[model samples]
Target: MWTKEFFGTDVYHLVSAFVIYSMLGWLVESIYMSFCNRRLTNRGFAKSPFCPIYGFGAIIGYLILHPLDGHFFKLYLLGALMATVFEFLVGNLMLKLFGEIWWDYKDKPCNYKGIICLESTIAWGFYAVIIIVFLHSKIIGFIDSWSFSMGSRVCSLILAIVTIDYIIQLSKAFGIDIRERCADKYESFKARWY
Candidate 1:
């Protein structure tokens, strides 16, 4: 399986895959929302032009489903399961940490706690097959072909941008000045520990 190569070598490719998939995810979300709302909607949770959750989900699906690739239907089922679990965990974690929900599927059919639904899982299954069987191979090859120094520079730049975007978005989601909250938390921790 081409995925075997995905496991350990070439950290640059993994980083590239993560960033590329994130941007693609953002594009898909934006296009879908635009169609639904009849206007452009930047559906990204962060100020960055990418969606990390989708990128992580894509990697997870690829890793989980690649072994079962020869058996297409079974691979899809497992991929759906992995993606659903990943979605649910990220949703609940966001709700816990930020007091906000990125998405609510309550109005959707067969939704579970507004985190996931049968329809979405089915779609994820389809996406998983395409990603694992087709996209991963090509992306890995392309990234691997790049010079190590060049790949390192590009990937590092992307990582820095995403890190800054996450910090800003997290602060915004607090709905109050983040500096105040951080100061308060720091004081509390100091009082308890020192």
Candidate 2:
């Protein structure tokens, strides 16, 4: 009865929500990168509009705003916008403080002439927005109506494991034989694209 009253026994709503959120994350990241960070387009990081980081951020946002019921959609959008602002501010500040670019997007379409990448920043902002909106709207009750108690737990666990694995691989690549090779390849790749 509770499920019928809330989610209406249809998982499509959840699926659609995630899809839209992920798309928003991609759009926001792409737009920010294009307008704010010109170097990303010149590099190559913005080549693909679909980024794992943004998707992950969307999921995080969804979870945070899951309790808002009918207002979840509005909360999600607001959260996403808030996240965008945060990303913009934090990114510009970091670039101003640091002389070296930590992330490069030489292959993407950016408008800024610096060592700033807006992809990750967008993702971070998106996640932050979701959390803030969810907390503000109290949507956790609706989320509880779902059948899966372990859903969020399971997803978080998987994400952590995968992220750790990727980090380890990147570390090994940086330290091992692939370091120079990857760098060279990346350089060539940048040259080809930009």
Candidate 3:
């Protein structure tokens, strides 16, 4: 697969990892946000239950921090640094592209321009240790259980859904009313389900 050639992993493995991590990230963030705000919040750029930043961070940690696995302290420190950098970049990119930051750490102690903070970076270190040393093997094992063809097909379908959601969200960011344009069908579907 192209992912194998480019990322040194099969399509099923890489895409599954991305989608799974993204969903988990969304769940975590949504729960945290809902608790903080005392109301439910869907914490993601896309309307779908996926956070691409988390997926990218997980992949980067899997590839980069795997080498430091046995060195606990080193792994923690490096993971913190890596994740902080990634967070800073993504945060800034969103600000530049959308004239808004999806998350702000200004209220946090030791924050840098509200883009990154010390506490979050420290938590990221622990997260790296837990995910790499504890959770990753199980996640990989679960992914491995699925047949390649079936897993790839499912991943493809999910990617398509996420991509469409992303495009819709991007359009909204640019002041395009895609749902408004499709209001009849959208309302009908919502009325049926909700």
Candidate 4:
């Protein structure tokens, strides 16, 4: 019974795995940026860590590929390819429409034209690899045990973060001085109410 319980479905484990992998990707990129100590610039997008576009892309990738089984290596490769395509298309479209790049990898070894960094690509690839390997090996059966509610909650958290980040960025793009505006509004409200 204990053994069965230990191996039972645990949505928390799946959510934790996703969060860990995402955070690891951010950490790796931050380390790379720190070593360079230069603001990354590129032809297409703006430089930002909390890119909502990439967040959405990642989520999409998970949705599309997570249901498939068999041929772990092949699936991983296909997922990587899909991710790359998504990144490229989204980056280009954003540049064309908004005239800003959401990320910059200018100084990194794997960066090309500041638009796409090799580190990010490799990180995403590794993420897919981990999922594929784990699912195939059944070494950690937690993912299979995860509850739907837990999975939805995790995805919701990610989406909320991405939405907030995007809103901040849009405000920046429009040159809205949120800090100053908020201060002025607060002072006015205080004077009127008091």
What TM-scores do the predictions have? 0.84, 0.31, 0.88, 0.52
Residue 161 accuracy (lDDT) in model 3 = 94
Residue 43, candidate 4: alpha-carbon lDDT? 18
Q: What TM-score number comes out for model 2?
A: 0.31
Residue 180 in candidate 3, Cα distance off native in Å: 9.0
Ranked candidates (TM-score, high to low): 3, 1, 4, 2
Error of 2 at 43 (Å): 9.2
Top model number, TM-score:
3
Q: What ranges in model 1 sit over 4 Å off?
A: 1-6, 175-194
lDDT score at residue 80, model 4, on the 0-100 scale = 73
* Model 4 accuracy (lDDT, Cα): 0.58
- Scored by lDDT, the top model is 3
**Alpha carbon lDDT of residue 144, candidate 3?**
86
Please give the distance, in angstroms, between residue 117's alpha carbon in candidate 3 and its true position after superposition: 0.5
| Model 1 agreement with the true structure over 1-194: per-residue lDDT tens digits | 22235565445566788888998899998999899889989989877788989888887677667788778898788888888888889989988987767888898999998989998889888888889888889888888798777877887898799898888777777666877888999999999998
* Candidate no. 1 TM-score: 0.84
Report the C-alpha lDDT of model 2 over 1-194, residue by residue, as the tens digit.
Answer: 11233333234334333434444556765676677766543221233333444444555445555555457456546565655554455456656754334355455455244333455445444455545554323433444555464545444454465456555554664465555777999999999999
Better of 1 and 4 by TM-score: 1
Please give the lDDT score for candidate 2. 0.49
lDDT, candidate 3, 40-69, per-residue tens: 999988889999899989987987888787
User: Which scores greater on lDDT, model 2 or model 3?
Assistant: 3
Predicted candidate 2, C-alpha RMSD: 13.2
Candidate 4: segments with Cα more than 4 A from true spot: 1-21, 35-55, 96-98, 104-126, 135-170, 187-194
